[model samples]
Target chain A: MDATQLIHPLLALALAPLMAGIVNKTKSAFAGRNGPPVLQPYRDLWRLLHKGAVYSRTTSWILRAGPIVSLAAVVTALAMLPFGGTAAPLSFAGDLIVFAYLFGLVRFLMVAAALDTGSSFEGMGASREVTFSALAEPALLLALAALARMAGSPSLSGLLAGAVANPAVSIPVLLLAAAAVGIVLLAENARIPVDDPNTHLELTMIHEVMILDTSGPDLAFAGYAALLKQWAFAALLVGVLVPWRTGVLWADVALALAAMAAVAVGIGVVESTMARLRLVRVPQLLLAAVACAALAVVLVLR
Target chain B: MDFWVNCLVVLIAMTNLRLLGSSRVVSCVHTVAFQGVLLGVLAIVGASGGLAAHGIVLAAVNIVLKGLVFPWLLMRALRETHLRREVEPAIGFGASMLLGVLLIGICLWIGSRLPLPVGVQASPLLVPAALFTLMVGLFMIVARRKALTQVVGYLSIENGITAFGLGFALKEALLVELGILLDAFMAVFVMGIIIFHISREFDHIDAGELSALKD
Candidate 1:
């Protein structure tokens, strides 16, 4: 692997938590409260890292392993992802499908861990996550497949690089993908409109309640991993939007960073402006993503 | 590898028969677990031909995750549930088995009709095995009332798909193979959790009891 490939996973690890922090700060500002510092999550991670975890009495090793496995899986996925049009360390045909499935692996672990706690509320959240993701996956694949068809390349790097040549198609497809991904971000990250990350009420919570019993570094890992996932999604969005040119690395890098920030801000705005959807309504939101992505595929094929 | 694949086909057929002929949850789980091990062996055999480091690693993952870990987890669940037999089946055993046979016949008929692509000699048995596995999985899901049994059925269907994938696409992309394996593992894991929860809340693992949320 080249230097760029080696750096991608480290870069993902470093930048992910910041995206979460930025969203939290943005939401705080919108709510007229003095928001936690943008580095609050970092501090939280540090504190959690130094402390001892309190395991739930009802939980098994699966609960303890959830965050570790989740972080490892996402990091592995990041290793497989390209940055700024560079090939990942493990590029192969249909690697994008692996990328999708790796995320599924993490989701599966998260849900299982939640269930291990034996909380009905957590179970409810787990159910929602699974059901919505099953619907969301086809959209994710259909969009990627559209890009794959357009580029005649199934690798994520090739699809991103080749598809950008046609701005008319790429932009709309990216927009649609971004919309779908945005919903996924909210749903997966337990953000507002699909879940209330900050809610104190256990019954209504999704992601937070699932982790209610976890403490110390395990919580830190889970929280940090969630941030990394958002960053990865944002990076993927950036890859779709910014075209890579030889000797234009600076421009590409700047655009990618800016796009990440924009995504963070956009997520914040959504969280600030919207209320959590009713449980039933969340599926409709995800379905809208599926619909948009499917349309994008049809359009690209046409 | 060919031998392993044939063994998988046989296991798939047995699992289908169990799903069709028995109303017992424990029996179904045991059959599916047996199939999972067959899939692991098939993975190893499939990978053995290439002799690449990637293939070796993938084969190891297949054995550990699919063969050993998953079955062990299912057995743990089975022990906890203490419910050995499926009390009632959605479809009668004889009828489902008859349908399964018809589906296999259809698969063979379809496989024989498709023309081979250039440079490729398609296997006559592969398509039929896959289709039969698919049909059996769907039948298991529809014919069984218990949530756990449905999951076992789903895994069997995935096994069939995995077998077909190995036959056709395994040589095409290692990534795809790994992806499918990972997805199937995660899917079963998720399904297991859901089943556990359903049993906890409803006092039983029946799929019909999960209808409380419907509009």
Candidate 2:
């Protein structure tokens, strides 16, 4: 196994919670509020680990198992995702497709667990999530497919590693794909505009409401999984943007980290500046990703 | 491995036939279960000559969940609901079967026309089997009136993909394949519970009756 391959999973696991904390701080700073420290999320996780959970009267064991499954699935996905053009700890030809579907699995569990609670609010969120993600997936796939075609390789690492070697025309397509995926990240991770994580109204929330009944270590696992997902997406975007060079190991790693931070800051800015879109409008936003991805496809094919 | 791939193809064809001919929800669940088990066997066969521990684990999970646990769960639910017979399909059984045959032809034709890339030794049967399964799944989802049947159809499609994945690229990361299987299982599990709840609340399982969402 390559040293870089080993580093990817470690970096992903270590930085995920911090990324969540950073996003919170940035959003707070943008709102002009004295934000909680960047370490707040870690503290929350630690506290939750020691606390006891309260279960819904209607839930089955699946509800309790949701966070455990979510964490496992996300970590599994991270294990397959390549960072900085290096191979993931686990990779195969066409692994990217699997990566997308694994995340789908996480979504499936989260939604099911939410619905298991028999809370109407959670059901509503689950319904919307499935609907939007169904549309979002093809767009995500097509975007990566375009990149794959351009790089002449089907693997995620190969496509992203080769991205920087493309001509100038490819830059626009890459940027557009990044932007599209960035929006998907926000929608998927339950950031602002797509969802307000801070919202008190369960009726208007997406991710948070689904876990209204979760507590203790389960909550910690869920929180960590969410952050891990965000980090994975950011890493993917970083792989797309940062140039790949074998000799520049330190520079590549640095650039990847910076790109990730930039994504967090971007999310914070969006959260601070914009109000959440109406529920119906969320699909429209997802459609934009489809449209942009379609453009990338046309460009690559042309 | 080739024999296993052939078995998967036959099973895919059987699933298509079941979807086209059977109105019984329980039978449809059983057919999907058979497909799932065949797929699990295919995964094991595909991994037999390889050293990927992950792939073996994935195959084991697929066998246990897709083959045994899921089917058992669906069957239990079927018994509880006592809705065994499908009354009328959107398309007649004979016509649907004919369409299924035509779909297999299309799959075969498409599979033959595509040139296999170098260093890839995918079985000729793999692609068609996948396409056939996918089409059958889509057909079941559309033709069936009951929401539970539609969910089963979706699971069948996932199984088809898994079979194809094993045949074409099982040597790649097994994590994603495992994840996909886990996701499908959980999705079906959740959908099954929801279907039960919906049936209990509405006193019917037809998608047409759940028109409360429409404006």
Candidate 3:
């Protein structure tokens, strides 16, 4: 691969933390308060990395391995994502399946680490995370499948590129898939109407609860990985929503970055305006996403 | 013309799905009203000429009665009765939706097999769309417990039949079609009045409770 193919992944890693900051600032703006700077997440990650590591007495080797493995999985997934019609460094047939399960691997590792801590609170978080993610997985896969059918490509790069390549045949199908993936992005990232990431209470948390015990560099790794995953999903959404491909590398890259920011603002608006769904209702929301995807598949087939 | 008809068909299907999934009574009313409006458009579109005078009259009556008059009457009844919630259904939303999909599949299979009158200019999807909407309307009436929702279901069934009529009955005698429309209007108007009285007496509008009438 040429050095230019490296740009998308590198940009994703460097800019991931900024998404958290944008969401925070947007939430703060809606609440009529001066929020942390847009660079606050990056600053926080830096601070965490400088601190020494901490380990629990009851934990085994898995505890130490969780953050690294999860982050590594996210990075691997990022390698296949095409930002704004630009192909990834690694593109292959059936890479979409690998892309999905890499995040699943991240969740599995996180849940395993949380369970290893032997705390009831962490276990509760793990259970909620697993249940919700299991429901969300079908939405993600079905949406991808619909896009694959529309584009006639089973791989991530090809699918994203193929989606924009022909707008006439794909617009309706793309619309349905975009909505489904949008819900998946919110649910997978622990956003509002799924699970509130910033809830002050531990009793109602899903993702934050799982990482409560980790500290220092490992915490930094976990935090960064979460942000990168958000960026990756947001990129997928942007590719679907904004299908403009100017052919020039810089224009496409710039448009992709701009679309990513727009998506962040959109998420913030959603978080501000809507109350989180009741725990029982989250499955219904995911089911709605599945229905959208399923309907898209039906339309494409018809 | 074909594209517009397909769009209308899709819009009709979506409203049926929303009606099946919606728990709130107001939104269900809105969905039924929207279906009514679409039926008016379909009537005009199904006309053989540029604008058949009879089709124009039918469209106007449908838009007025189904879209405006019935919803207004229902909302006024809702306000006076103060029975707004329909949170629980005899059949849950998810199961209803699955059954809706199955019903549509059945409609499509049956619609394709049934012979259509020769020289009809309408899309092939007309039969399936009409049958699907009809089944969903019946499903709503049978599955929902609230009297208002059942009435909405009844209106939905009327909308389905009107849709079917747009395809088959438009070529026949206009008096027969006009009578059908008048009958539906009168039935809903009476149902609205009865719903108000029932709510005033029983303090709830659950149709299941009407079984107590046998004693």
TM-score winner between candidates 2 and 3: 3
**DockQ of every predicted complex:** 0.01, 0.01, 0.26
The 10-residue segment of model 2 chain B with minimum total lDDT is B2-11
Candidate 3: tens digits of C-alpha lDDT, residues A41-117: 99999999999988989999888889999999999999999886567999999999999999999999999999999
- On the 0 to 100 scale, the lDDT of residue A124 in model 2 is 90
lDDT of 1: 0.72
Give the least accurate 10-residue stretch of model 2 chain A, judged by summed lDDT. Answer: A162-171
TM-score of 1: 0.57
After superposition, the stretches of candidate 1 with alpha carbons farther than 4 Å from their true spots are: A244-246, B1-215
Q: Pairs clashing in candidate 2?
A: A92-B172, B23-B86
Q: What CAPRI-style quality would you assign to candidate 1?
A: incorrect
Better of 1 and 2 by TM-score: 2
The residue pairs that clash in candidate 3, if any, are none
lDDT of 3: 0.85
lDDT of 1 by residue, B115-163 (tens): 6556542234556666777778887888888877787778778777876
Could you give candidate 2's per-residue lDDT for residues B1-215 as a string of tens digits? Answer: 45555444554555566566665677777778878877767766656457477766777788788878988877776666666466357876656765775676677777778776676666666777787788888888888788878888798789778866766563565767877877887897888787788778777778777777666
**Chain B TM-score of all predictions, in order?**
0.83, 0.89, 0.95
